[model samples]
Each structure stands twice: as C-alpha cells, then as structure tokens.
Target: MEHRIRHLSTYSYDPAALRVALRLKLFPVDHEGQQVESWKVTVNDEEVSPLVFSDLGDREALWSSEDALDQLTITAEGIVSTRETNGIVRGMPGFAPPGIYIRETELTEPDEAIRALMGEATGDDTLSRLHALMGLIHERVKYLTGSTSARTTAADALKDGKGVCQDHAQLFIAAARTAEVPARYVTGYLQMEEETEELLETHAWAEAHVDGIGWVGFDPSHNLCPTERYVRLCSGLDAFGASPIRGNVLGETKESLEVSVAIGQSQQ
Candidate 1:
C-alpha cells in the first residue's frame, strides 16, 4: 500500500501568549513493514530537520520562536509504502525492551474494573489472551467523536463506555498490563476505504509484546489488528507521551487549534 499523507495544524494563540515552542516526532523510519519514500516537516513556512537517535533510531526535533508570536502553523507531509505484516512488528531500528512498556503512566493505570476485565479474558496463551481482551474492549466501549478529552484516563473511558480511538487504545493497554502483558500506545495514520472503513482522524492504537511473536499491533476501536493501511509512527507508555506534537507556551493565554489531515491512497 502507498499513502501520501499531510497533517496541517494552525495554533491561534491569544495576544497574551508571548512565546511558544514545540517538540516534533513527525518523521517516520523505515522498518520491516513500511518504507518511507518521502517526508518533511515545516513550521510557519520554514522547513525543520529532525535527527534520529543513534542508539534508538527515534526521530526528534525542537522548534521555538525567538520573537513574540501570536499564531503558529505546522505541517508534516510524507509518502510511505507499507506491507501487511499480519500485525507482527519486526525489524524496527529501535530498542526499549518490553519491560519499559510495562511501566504504567497515570493515563493507563488500571482500576478495579480494568483488573476484573483482565480476569475475564480466557485464552490458551498470551497472544490469544490479548486477542480476547481486544474483543472485550471493543464490545465495551462506544466510539464517539469528541466524547473524551486528551486527559481522559483508561479507567474513565471504560467506566463511561464512550470515547475515541485514543480511549480505546489506552483502555486496552491498561487491561493488558494488568494481566502482566507488556503494552504501549501507538499514534499513526490509517488509510480508510470510504465504503468499508470508518474515517478517523490521527489514529491511535495499542501494541502488546507476545512471548514468541515480539510486538503486535491491535486496534481495539476497530476490533482488528493493524494492516497495510496503517502507517506506524511514534509510540510511548501512554497517549500523552506518544503524541506527534508536544508544545509549551510562555504566557497565560487561551489557545485554539485547527487541524486537518489528508490521506491519499495510490493504486501502485
């Protein structure tokens, strides 16, 4: 699968905002399942270059303003070729053993309900248990756009039974980790088939480490594993940590953001 994707965001900060800065994880690395054909990130109108970590292969960049600014615009565009790996993630030039993912963040901390969910999952092994857990979460949560915020925790989403993909992923991760399975959050793009797939924005999902299979991607919101239509991005212990863009401002002010993502599939 070939995908040409562009993510554009404009931040309209109030005049009270004096300065701003951002950390970008916009670059994608070539891995066993995907190949980066072309990619770039721009702030306002200037292109910024990010460096890949020598030890981890994670790409990162920092953008800041030297003068006072009231508004900012950022754009990340790229083309990637992907292959269906049957949800099996491999050959990625990075390392953070599964133990690191098992460490829970505030957003993924499981409550009594989530822990009970762990007990409800019946499977022959770790992989099958995760699959059962995925199905359980998808059945429990209702996918509602704008129903939850960035700060919503897995417990909150599960109790409410409503949220976006972010909530689904976090809930799944929380439950998995509760069962002693290592899981993490993944943020990326999904190329939807208009007639068959739900059109979603800035996709988020979960990946769990299986004993014999390594890391496997799962989309509990969609009740399926990630396929060729998915483009893997950065991941972390939780949603907040895995965000593509993290920002900071110097003054007290209200911030309004407008975001747009355009994904075009090619018949190649």
Candidate 2:
C-alpha cells in the first residue's frame, strides 16, 4: 500500500521577542517494509536553521532559539510507499540482541500489583503474558484524550481510568516490567480507511522481549501485532526516549503548539 502524509506543527507564543530553534524526528525512514517517496520540512521563519544528521535512534532535527523570539511554526509533508509484512519485522537495522531489552528503566520498575498480575497467569510464554497484560490494561483504563499528559505514570493512568494511546502503551510497558519482561515504546504511523477520521498525530504502541525472539511489536490499542498498515520509526524505554522530535530552549519565555497530520491511502 501507498500513503501520502502531511504533518504540520505550529507554535505561538504569548510574548514575542528574540529567536527560536527545535529538533525534529518527523521524517519517515526507509526500511525493509517502507520506502520514502518524497519528504520535506519548512519553517515559516526563513531565519530558522535547517535539519542536520544525527546518529540517534530515529530521524532528528535541531532548531535553535536565539535572542528573544516568541513565535515559532514548523511543518512537515511527505509521501511514502509501504508494503505489509507478515506481522514480523525480520531484520531491524539496530535491534540489540535478545537479552538487552530486558534491562529495566526507572519507570518500568515492577511492583506488587504487577507481580500479582503475573502470578495469576500460569504461563512462561512471553507472547501469552503480553496478550494477557494488554487485556488487563484495556479493562482497567478507558481511552480518553485530555485526562493524561505526557508525564503520566502507569499507575497514575490506571487509577485515573483514562488516557490516550501513549498512556495505554506506557501502562503496558510498566506492567511488563513488573513481570520482569522487557518492554519498549514504539513510535510510528497507521494508515486508516477512507471513511475513518483522526489521522493527524503520530501513533504509539509497545514491544516486548521474548526469550528466544528479539524485540516484537504489539499494539494494545488495537489488540494486535503491527502489520503492513503500520509504519515503524523508533523504540525506547518510553515516549520521552522515543519522542519524534526534541529541541533546545533559548530566551523564549512561553510557547504554544499546534499539530496536524493528513494520511491518505492510494492504489498500490
């Protein structure tokens, strides 16, 4: 399948004065299952700098804020042709060996609740445990957008009973960690049907480590493994680590952001 994607981010500041700069990881990458047809990024202010190369996990860009500038706007547009695979990404470019991902992060630390959850399920199979965990999260939390923020914790989201896709993925990661399973966050895109709505923001999910197999993708949001309709970008401990974009700050006092994405399916 082929898809045309456009992602636009605009930042408006309450007070305008000096300069602005940012890092962007919005570019779709070329990999086994996907091909980048054409991609471009444009900043409204000509004074802004262009993107540079980085050896980080995913595509990145740097934007600098000089002086005391207030307003900032960023836009990204692209087209990509992608093919669906059999639910598995066989040869990921930089995947660490099987044992590495099991290392735990601060947020992913396991607790009693997680241990108990693990105990209830009597299977050593990582895939089975992963599916069970996904079901637990789906039942625990209701999907709602504004109830959670980027920093919401797994326990917090569970208690609040609401969060978006990111929260669901994070909660799942946290739970897996409690069970001594290594899980990471995945950032990517999803192609929707012609009548479907909501295609602007990037999508997120989780991956768990199996004893023999390396890292594998799971979308608790959809209760399935990633397929041809999904586009993979990067993976890390959580959203903060796998953020699509990051940047440095200058004298700018305050800023607001707007994001829009348009994804369309084309005849293969």
Candidate 3:
C-alpha cells in the first residue's frame, strides 16, 4: 500500500519568551515493511533544521526559535509505501535488548486489575497469549475520544473502562509487562479507509517482543496487529517517551498547540 501523509503542528506562545527549542521524532521508521519515497519537514514555512538520527533509529529534528515570535509552525509531508508483515518489525536496526522494554514506566505501571487480566489471558504460547491480552483490553476499554486526557495513566484508564488509543496502548503495555512480555509503546499514522477529510491525526499502538519472532505490533484499540494501513513513527516505554515532539520554552509564557494530520491511499 502507498500513502500520502501530511502533518501540521502550530504553537502559539506569548512573545515574552526568549527562545523555544524542540526535538521532533516525526519521521517514519525505515524497515523491511515500509519504504519512504519522499519526506520533508518544515518550520514556519521554511525547510527544517538539520536532522540527526538517534541511536534508537528515529530521525530527530532540532528546531529552535531565537526571536520573540508569537507563533511557531511545523509541517511534515511524505509519501511512503508499506507492506503487511504480520505485525513483525524486521530489518530494522536494533538498539536495545528486549529485556530493556520489560522495565516499567510510570504510565505503564500495572495494578492488581491489570495483573488479573494478564493472568486470565495467559496461554502456553507467547503469541497466543499476547493476542488474547489485546482482545481482553479491547473488550474492557470503551473508545471514547474525550474520556481521558494526556496525563491519564493505564491504571486510570483500566479503572474507568474508557479511553482513547493512547490509553489502550498503555494498558496493553502494562498488561504485557505483568505477563513478563517485553512491550513498548508506538506512535504513528493510520490510513483510515472511511476518512475523506484533509485533516487527520496520529495513531498509537503497542509492540511486544516475542522470542524467536522479534518485535510484533499490536493495536488493542482495533483488536488486531498493525498491517499495511499502519505507518510506524517511533517507540518508547510509554506515550510521553515516544512523543512525536518534545520541546521547552525559554521564558515564562503561556503556550497553546494545534495539530492536524491527513493520510490517504495514493495512486502509485
């Protein structure tokens, strides 16, 4: 499958600020399942700053504003071709050992409920057990757009029984960890077949390391593995760790953000 992706992020900050700096991990990962045909990033209508690939294999763009600007805008546009790999991430450079992903993060900390769910879904085979866990989470958590916030943790989402994709990914990560599976959070874009608008948004999923099979993507929100429709961006212990953008304001000022993304199948 081929896709056209466009992402726009606008930040409005009080001019009282001295400088603003940000690190962007918005570039899609280059792996066996996906190929980048053309990609570009820009800020305030200008080409992006120098890009550096992180040790983890994610492309990083260092963007900074030195002037007292009222707003900053960043845009990323690209065309990518992807193939279904049964959710297995292969041909990608490995950064850390699988055991590293087993470490718990604050957002993915499992509670009694998560442990119970993991136990009930556990099976002899790791792959089957993971699939069961994903289904269990999908069934338990209702997808409500505004039911949770960015700061909401997996435990909180599980308790409330309502959340968005981030919550589902986090909850799945937590449960997988409790079951002794090494899982990480993934952020990316999903080309929805029903979407007809020019403005879309990013998506989140989870990846677990299966012995002998490597890392496999699982999307509890859809109760399935990522396929050709999925385009991976980055991965970390949780949402915050894998955020597409991370930045700091140099002065005391208020800031507001707006993001728009559009993804659709393209004629090759």
Every candidate's lDDT: 0.87, 0.69, 0.88
**Could you tell me how far off, in angstroms, the CA of residue 169 lies in candidate 2 after the best superposition?**
0.7
What's model 2's lDDT at 18? 58
lDDT of 3: 0.88
- Which of 1 and 3 is ahead in lDDT? 3
**Candidate ordering by lDDT (highest first):** 3, 1, 2
Candidate 3 local lDDT, residue 220: 95
What lDDT does candidate 1 reach at residue 89? 84
* Two-way TM-score contest, 1 vs 2, winner: 1
Q: Candidate 2: global Cα-lDDT?
A: 0.69
Candidate 2 ranges with C-alpha deviation above 4 Å: 45-56, 65-68, 95-100, 121-124, 194-197
Model 1 spans with C-alpha error above 4 angstroms:
52-57, 195-200
What TM-scores do the predictions have?
A: 0.95, 0.84, 0.95
Candidate 3 segments exceeding 4 Å error: 196-198
